[model samples]
Each structure stands twice: as structure tokens, then as C-alpha cells.
Target: MKATTFPGMSLDIDIQELTPVQWPALEKLFGKNGACVGCWCMFWRLEEGERFQDVKGASAKQRMKALVAQGQARGLLAYVEGEPVGWLTFGPRRSFPRLDRAPSLKCDDADEVWSLPCFFIHKDFRNQGVATALLKFAMDTLRQRGVSTLEGYPVKVPAGATRVANSSAYTGTVPFFEKQGFKSVAERPQGKQRMRKSLVLRRSARKQGS
Candidate 1:
């Protein structure tokens, strides 16, 4: 299948594998609010309580830059006409400390699954179906890397709940997951629930507990 191209922004987006050079563009896309203030997304990547002071301002920004310097292509970027307008952070489950420690985000299968940690789409591009596209691109990118499964923690909203800040986890909405072929594989006591989609690549021997 061909990759998507949103031409309004002259969106000749090259959804290539992310690298160190791309992190700055990712940061710029996140902007002064840290894509929603104080969350360089180190919340899940940092030790508990260690972020209280560092995750705000320049401190948190620096830390993430260091990770990039270490060659961590934590996620993918949607470059439109050469300017980064979207970002999605996804990687190995264990790589993100917060999700692994979260009550329900934990996985039942031990096949070394990759998880869609979250997203940070620019505010202007919020309603443009960018998040869903990012999800698909992330899956395809990891598919080539040989991931057996992919999972995400989208906010589970019911019929009458009011809309809240998009930054809440920037994880995403449950309906979005359903659209992406993800089903409720696990539920959390809190509103945040784990949604997953199994990749059609290599099968896990772990699937059958012989």
C-alpha cells in the first residue's frame, strides 16, 4: 500500500525512520508547552517522582535531547513541506518505564511486544486525522522491524463525558483504536485502558502455552 500525503501544507511528508537529527524537529513541534506543558514525555520514561522538577522548562527538554543523542528514535515524525508538524512516540514496552508500571497497561503475553507510548500532534493539526495516520505509520514502521504485537492506552470515554484536554496522555481515544483494528485486550481500573492490535507478521511461539 502507498503511504499517505497531505498536500495542503505541501505535505510531501517523508515518514522515514526517525533519527537523532529529527529529535529537534520533534521538540519544535511539541513547542513551549512541551506539547502540553511539562511533559517532554519523560513521565513514562523517567523514574517516579524524579520528573517533578525537571519535566518543566529546559531541564526536561535537555533530558530528551540526550536520549536522542543516544540514538533513540523513540517515535516517528510527519514532516510537511519540510517542517515537522506531527509526532508519535512508540517503542518497546519495557523501554517506557511508566506504562510498564501502570496497573493495566501491562501485557499478558511475554513476547517482547512493542507499544505505542503516545502522541503529541501540534495543536493546529489536532483534528486533521493526523493521530490515526501516525498510528498506522508507527505500526508499519515497527512491522518492518519484526514486532509481533502493538498496543496503546487510549482514553476510554463513555457516552456523556465532557471533552478534556488533549494532553491528558495524548495517548488517544478508544474509538480511534477500534478504528485501527485494536480491541480491548486489557482494562484498567482508571479511565486509561490498554487497547491492542496483533500484527500479522511472525507469530509468537508463546501464543500456544504448550
Candidate 2:
């Protein structure tokens, strides 16, 4: 993908797909905390019965690297000038096994959907539209790949609150996804929500609808 500079921003932001060669950029973006208390962005990728705490830090980082090397983990990174500043994780629904176990997110069309489960933007770049830019790029990329639907599990902040804490916003905020055309389809516990967006037009059964 080409480098893009969104309006109202002076610096150019480039979005690129994750690959082995781009691991260093991701590493630099994630920093020592692994993008939130040593998560290393492996929360949703964990298998059933796998504990996140066990692989929280360096182990989690290594596991992510392994997935990148083996071509299993998929995501996109956003860069400004030459520094990585943002990330978005997405792939086939089945690839994110944890989603299968989520009671609220369960659906019959799992096989036909792509899941976008996480995003991380550098602290310095937060609220500058980096996340929105990344999401738009991912949508375009997936649509071009013929994906018909995309899903995300974002956190819904409490009413009357103007902003959610950064930690709770990792999955993104409901308004953010709604601005991107996603609709809340189910309510999960703990203010989390299951939202979906259709990437393509569905076939009509009738020539003229009543």
C-alpha cells in the first residue's frame, strides 16, 4: 500500500501489512510493555485453556514473532515518516480461537467473516486519527480480498463519560467503530460489544422488493 497523509495532519502516515521483515517496526511500536501490560497483542490469539499471564511478557513477544515467521499472524502497521505508530490485528474468524468461546460473539456465519480483534496506537499519536486511518485501510484491503463481512469487539464506555481509559480502549470504542459503519449486534459482558460491518452487497432474492 502507498503512504497516505490524511487531512488536517502535517506528517504522512503509511500503512503496511505485517510480515517477517516488518517485525522490528512492530517491536519498536509495541515497546517494553508489549502494548499493554505485556500482552504483546496475543490476547485473542491464545488457545482455549491458555492463560495470558503465563505468556505475558517476553514469551508472548516470542510467540507473536513465531506466528509472523510462520505466516499465521496477520495485521497492519501504520508509520509516520519512518517510525511505526499504530497497529491493527485481523484474520479469519477461526484463526482467533478465543472468539469461538465468547458466548456473546458466537454466530452461525463464523466461516464467512474476518475478525479485527485489536488495535494499538502509540501514546503520542492517540486521538490524531491514526486508528481511524488504520481501520479504513484494513477495510479496503479486506474488501479487495473479497471478504464479505468484518467484525470487531470494541469496548463501550459508560454513559456520560467523554473518554475511556487507554487500557480499556485497546479493542477500540463503540463510537469509533460506528463511525466506520459497524453496528452493534450483540452485547457482551463488561461493556464489551460485538459489532459487524458488511463489506459487500448481498444478493437479492427478488428483482423488485415490496
TM per model? 0.83, 0.91
C-alpha lDDT values of all predictions: 0.72, 0.88
- Model 1 reaches what TM-score against the true structure? 0.83
For candidate 1, what's the RMSD? Answer: 5.3
What digit string (tens of lDDT, one per residue) describes model 2 on residues 1-210? 344555655456788888888899999999999999999889988998999889799999999999988979899999887899999999999999988898877889899999999999999999888999899999988987999899999998887888889989999999899999999888654577999999985456223432
User: Which candidate leads in lDDT?
Assistant: 2
The parts of candidate 2 lying over 4 Å away from their true place are: 1-11, 188-190, 201-210
Lowest lDDT block of 10, candidate 2: 201-210
Off by over 4 Å in 1: 1-14, 48-54, 188-190, 201-210
Backbone clashes for every candidate come to 1, 0
Pairs in steric clash, model 1? 33-37
